[model samples]
Target chain A: MDFRINDEQRQMRETAQEFFEDREVLERARERIDGEDVVDDLWDDLSEMDYPALTVPLEHGGLGDDVLYLSLLLEEAGRVALPAPLPETLAFGAFVLDELGSDAQKEQFLPAIADGDQRLSFALYESGQESLPRDIQLAATPTDDGYRLDGTKTLVPFGEQVDTIVVAARTGSGTGMDGVSLFLVDAERVDSEPQDTLDRTRPAAKLHFDDFEIGENALLGTEGEAGPTLQKAMDRYTVATCAMTVGAASRAVEMSSDYGSQREQFDKPIGQFQAVKHRIADMWMATQAARSLTYYAAWALENDEPDAARAVSEAKLFCSEQLTQVFADDIHNHGGMGFTSEHDGHIYFKQAKAWETFLGTPTEHLDRIADSHEL
Target chain B: MDFEYTEDQERFRQELREWLRENLPDGWQAGERPGTDDPEENVEFLLDWQRTLNDGGWAGLHWPEEYGGADASLLEQVIYNQETARVDAPARINAVGIDFVGPTLMELGTDEQKERFLPKIISGEELWCQGYSEPDAGSDLASLSLSAERNGDEFLLNGQKVWTSYAHVADWCFLLTRTDDSGPKHHGITVFLVDMDQEGIQTEPIHQITDETDFNEVFFDDAVAREEHIVGEIDEGWEVAMTLSAFEHSMSDVFSIEQRWRSLVEFCQEHERDGTPLAEHTHVRRELARLHTRIQAGKLTHYRNVSKQMETGVPGPEGSMDKVFNNQTEKKLENFARRLLGANNALWTDGPDDGQWVTDLLMPYGKMIAGGTKDVQRNIIAERVLGLPKDD
Candidate 1:
């Protein structure tokens, strides 16, 4: 069996890279983080290319590319450290809508998503309960016709700017996984403020859904039946984030290797030393391994493998750990300048750290792997 | 890309699997080998097994059909390895000959050399060991100082070859020695197909940390190698050596690694500590999961290298990638097994699987050093693959 991507996937990857490169994505990312809430031109370009419809089925006015293609797109977004809501809008937003949204919901929202007429974000984690979404404290109380959403979701991607959000909230009595439900709510009804995250390239915000109300049609699936669907979406998100991590770590490795060749010490390039060479080698190997498993997880999700969750969790855990190590080694490869803000080292490292715990920590995923497989 | 094997490859896999099931020495999966308790008998038994493999046309899979090999495609080779590993079959006694000598000879051997040696090597009638590493040259293999002097139709060889695996049982050796000491150290070297039973050759077994004597130091004092036995041009053996080393990093034994992992998991399943099965411990479970995941990635990494090998017919720095990844994964797996087994890991024969864990734990450091030290792999990656400056 071959592990290399086919020609189409390679073309997709190259196109994504060329687009991002032409747009000066990373440079613009830095500006968007501190200066503006969004980059409209970049968003419009992505939508025009139908990037958001990648995972949606062909019947839904989308490309019907599998999770593998989506992974490649996210990977490109990561390589540039693009400060946008791509993952939120494409991976979490689009895939969840495709999988769990009824036909009417798909027709009403997917075209807007595909055309860049609307933006969507995900709100999963609550304050102090970052390890598991089972403890989602966002309450959705039953009303005459629909439900009222209250409580805060910390660390929501693009929480302040998106118009629509797919939110996870507690609907039943107990706080276990079964009581959780997902709903699409209007972002205007919530109070949002950007949080100061270590990764400034991709800004996150704290969203407070204070008594936000939505009709029954806003429920993603049957009432209180959104648990498994939410889980499926979260698993895809984990794998997608891992794809991004691989991209960032890979770029970090490339940058370090480039710098090592040009920089010199002891009358020779520092990279000539066995110490520096081996560390750089280790970084490359780690990124390769991380990338391999990330793609494997994407394949598993696309194939609907019975072990998809396990594979996704494994990928997330392994890639997170490897990416963190790669970032640290990359920094070390740069010497004193690595620690300074002048180099790109800190940017990738901070982004790596931010995504390390985006969905869950490596430890949390390890726990899931063990618990799910009953190992 | 699809991970599933094609139907034809799957059929080949089934045939190989059935053959292994029908022909493996009884109780092989229990870590039992023929004559495990007697060293001489073990050698003889392994030789017999190698010959048996030849009879079944399962030897030298990458060699040409004229040499009695199937000339299997890369995918078939991978499938064969995976199947052999699934059943934990005995390792071929002539692995050095099959994996290295035959392939290199195909690329560089004279027609006469191939006619005289390839059949015997593939048939397991003559076993070969590598005589590359020396007491002075380990990681820096090119600086090897083994000297060879031309004497009529014979070359007199003199030097010490250390860490020569299977030297004691080998009938032949592919050795490197200096034919001319006038130029750069790498130049003036020649590779010879030396008869191990020659009058001037002496092999003394060297016991490793696990107290096994698979490695040896072969002293050659005027040892005779026929002049016609040179595999490539004299003083240019470095290219031949590099080719052989590239084959070493192919990592066809990934399935063997998977087997070891399976054994470790079963061990944890059966053993208990603190009034619970070891597998029940959260820390143990976490480590197990991590090791499993890393091995999965390692296998894919191997496949990636194989895919490149298929297209290019030559290995690249990505070979070093596989080397580092496999080396680290093996070390981590063995270390985790050791820690999980605790005091029981110290047992030589009374412990689980006849005390394999102790030996397995101690054996992986050599993996890091063999074929090329981990340091050399990193250097190759940095310089050749990443285009970094050479070491000063």
Candidate 2:
């Protein structure tokens, strides 16, 4: 019943935060501010910590932790604004492999992530569309053994660093929420180019899968039932992204509040003014509510609630909407200094702007909510 | 984190739901109180029903059992409201006493106050009306200027309380009076339980746009109040009224909101515009689904608050969040009803077409504007919840 994070979560949060504090999540985040492909070092650290095996069963040499832990890890990655997609690799690697890829896929891919030897990513979201299922434009035609992955997956965050990718490719018709299946492909075969993005922390690439070949083991799950599995992966990713937004926005609000107090105006602390005070107050409430819901969503994910998708939507809705508002209000409350490129406010602001479209926009969530249960 | 009610709680909900289902008294769909529809028949029916509730030991769920109260659990209280609202339950016949005065008395009332007043409220013998907002004071409640000069054991009261809901129907007024002219504004107010039958007390019914004279302007012209009639401490009434207002808004939000959501759904289910039920259309379905999702989210938040109360013994400020969320949802639900029902939503009738669509749509917009406006809630959230600076 309690909304506050438990001691275990606090411990996990500290571990995750401390992990990122030690290194950039992906080398490319810091390197790619000027470079094309990000060289990731934090992945080794994450692999050392076994984050890639985060949700694998205890027998798998990875922590059998649930989405709650993953969400906390996501928050830290978000707080540090890292680029690795620890959640995607860990989640897609574990969930898809376990659910659809058969035992061999699990044995081959999970240990690499669990032992920190290799990483995995999911090529789900298509160009200009947020939905993984409803917006299934990618085609996956089958060959003698496995399927050929085609169509473009734009904005694949940290797609280049991974050893493997689980791509959602259409095997049949029924384009709405059906007609989609996932394929696991070794990235060496694809001729992909990393796309430049405003968010330096998360490097993304436009994956050009010109009829890429994958083995029969590459079909992660049921041949045509990729929609539901990708959805499950998205549940992990959305919650992860939301957790990140919560922590980052929370820090931004904190930084903004402290600045308001010490940085005075009109012969008094600027925060003493009601308008400034009220704006910060709004940010604080928004952050708290958003954080509460994100953790709750995480708990739901861990609990295996059927309503996890809705929780994902709720977390994304609150986090995305509130993060943008908090950053905007934070910047405004700090006044002129908030706009300086050197200031952290602008960094958080740009991050928030970029994230506003990452998983989905607020309207998309509202539309998703419109489709969930109550209706 | 779990939204499921306990087995016992579920059973209790079922039992009450069954009872209310069987006891769906007519004439409530038009939003008219049964007693108002036909005072003799309605009052007799309502009082008898209250007696039955009292006999079942279901009266005053939040009240301690000492004074005819049920001492119910959080889930029990919610279940009672949900079941009661589900069947409409004859408009409670005595909501003023049950929801407002009873909760206020439980919080700040002395033993004597609780003993003397609670049983009557529980038994539905005496109705109560709130006298906090004045002609000049609404959201700026502390600036209320009602005067109460002490004359020996009695206080001579003089002031006008406007927008007093159900003043014409209530037997007593829980009035707020300025006890001290010398002290600061908030510190000098005192809460009094004044009999509406007192000398120099005038009640003038104020007709609303709904053509209802339910609200009244209660005036006190040197109205007398005995020393024992004061509900709480002398010159400390503002705190009591604040507590009461908080309880009022919170209770209204939990039960009334669910009622609004259901009406919207049922309206959508039955509504038609282009020779089809509105629920059949994609946009309409999406709108309904969105509202449903928000309702579930709000329910989760409400359940969290319920859990907090179950452990902590008090509802927190998240009640404000509940109100803010529900207020807009209620409006949106109503708006959706209008869009779906169209011309059918425009007519308010006691017949089959009784303004079920129209009244349900228009009724609650004022709940947000009237109580503590949504702007105040946003401010409360900013300063209290969000740690925002005051706007001054």
Candidate 3:
């Protein structure tokens, strides 16, 4: 009944953790950078292992699992500090295709992702990173036999390499979240390339759609009805993202506790000190509370919970804000050695920096919650 | 992680609702309780009804067994209140005794005090008022100049407590006084339970905005309180006050509020001006819808509290959070009701049965101001919940 990973997902997580353990996970993460997006061999290894197929429907070359399965996969990604977009591209990419894409699009696109034949990334954020689908500004106007889209999309995750780009755009003049539609234009059709984002390991781009042409088949879901669909997709994505951040924070707290226990100051391990112990205790409680909310969010999304958006936003914002301090303090608690290149602390520290703003930052997520509650 | 209530708990919820319907007195159930300004309003009858509840084993749900309480489960307590208030049963007669003094006594009072005071509270034989503030010590409560000095086997108490709600009628007062002159302001205090009918106890009633003289300034001159009457360790009254204040802040009366909302809703739809039902307006509908949502959020906040208490066993910082949500929501509901009721609000703005829309709105200001201020709750969060650096 709790919002937690089930037995199968737990087992799957351990397996993935083992995979990263063998690959010298830290080494691979450190080797990667912004432009290069160091997910080279990892993506193949994942596809060969059929990890990408877990959340994809069986008809689309996957194990026919639910959002719960994707949560576990994201947790695995967090634990290993793997510099990859499997959690975003595979989990999110597959979900959009299943929910909003037509039968043809699912058949034509999902199997390639499931079979490791192609990589896909979603580009939902318009310029200024509008967190809510209703506020999207990218406009797609009707044309002869197709549509002509002219808009700029920022914060498009992994925009460079992915072959599929799921885009949300305005189809009508209705303001503030209505009259919107979702389309899956070919990534090659996008006129812009990936922009160098703050977190080099995870590339996001500003997509400039100048006279971008799409056939009638490219329209995803119903016209002027993409807001709800995009919301549905965002719920799954936000929950899964929160799942990753929770794992990363849990790891940070654990690593800090371990280091504090073993590293001594003045004649004993620093962990025994009241100041250090109390902080660790507080962090443990925060981690547990954040985990509870995040897992609940996953359950709500997977179970078609009616309040999914509210729960998802609450969870995402909580974890996003909590993880930043949990790890930042981990560095503080380590004193000096924690900052050295040899230390594993940087992995979480870097992940926190990237995640703090991912999927529209903590403040934006909080506004969604405030709005939902009519605050 | 699980938010589902157990089947037994759910069943108790239903039974409680039914029992509240059948057992409660008619006027008390409407809890549109008459104002004290009108003695004919029969508020005394509501007090008697409270005793009926105590007799029915429904009172003191949160108290320990030793205190004549059933020591009910937290969920059961919530359900009992939710049911009682849903039906608009009159509020308990002595809020100070039940919510404030009773809990503080259970926590820090001596065994003899528990035996002497507990049964009387349950039987409604004794009502309690707080004497925490003097004229000058209003918000800076610890600066209270009330003195309690050792005089043989008893202490001679002399203080003037202002804004003592219902002091004119209370049987006893939970009084805070300065017991020492040598130490820190917080260190030299003691809490005592003093009989209101003592030799030198006198009260002067003060009329408030609602034209009720239920509140007064109580003066104590050489009042004698036995050593056994002191609650908690001597010279450590601040600690007891802080703990009691925490409960005073976060503990929400969700069960009671549900009924208030219902009554407010009923009042709006039942009365009208011109030819239209007052509830027909779009603005009213939207406001009610928003109020319902806030109530839902408040309910969820309380549920989270239950889950937390289940996890932590004792309420911690979240107590402040509950306080913040309930007080804020109550104020909003009051304002919402006032706007919906319109000019009808002005008609009863002075009567005993005056439409509570305006009263409810004014009451919110008091709710947030009393127990603890809004800023204090935020400070608790910023310090205790957020782990921020305290202001030096």
Q: Candidate 2: misplaced stretches above 4 Å?
A: A1-7, A14-39, A44-51, A76-80, A125-131, A134-152, A170-180, A210-213, A248-375, B26-52, B90-96, B103-108, B242-259, B343-353
lDDT per residue for candidate 3 within B34-105, as digits (tens), equals 543474255576578778878877767677777777677777776666665566666687667877788887
Most lDDT-accurate candidate? 1
The C-alpha RMSD of each candidate to the native structure, in angstroms, is: 1.9, 4.1, 8.6
**lDDT per residue (tens digit) for residues A49-78 in model 2:** 767777877776778888777777777777
Minimum summed lDDT over a 10-residue window in model 1 chain A is located at: A32-41
Model 2: how far residue A94 lies from native, Å: 1.7
In model 1 chain B, which range of ten residues has the least summed lDDT? B245-254
| DockQ of all predictions against the true structure, Cα-based | 0.80, 0.35, 0.11
Say which prediction, candidate 1 or candidate 2, comes out ahead on DockQ.
1
lDDT over C-alpha atoms for residue B328 of model 1:
81
lDDT of 1 by residue, A226-257 (tens): 77777787888888888888888888888988
Higher-TM-score candidate of 2 and 3: 2
Which of the CAPRI classes, incorrect, acceptable, medium or high, describes model 1?
medium
How well does candidate 3 reproduce the true complex, by DockQ? 0.11
**Global lDDT of each candidate:** 0.82, 0.72, 0.71
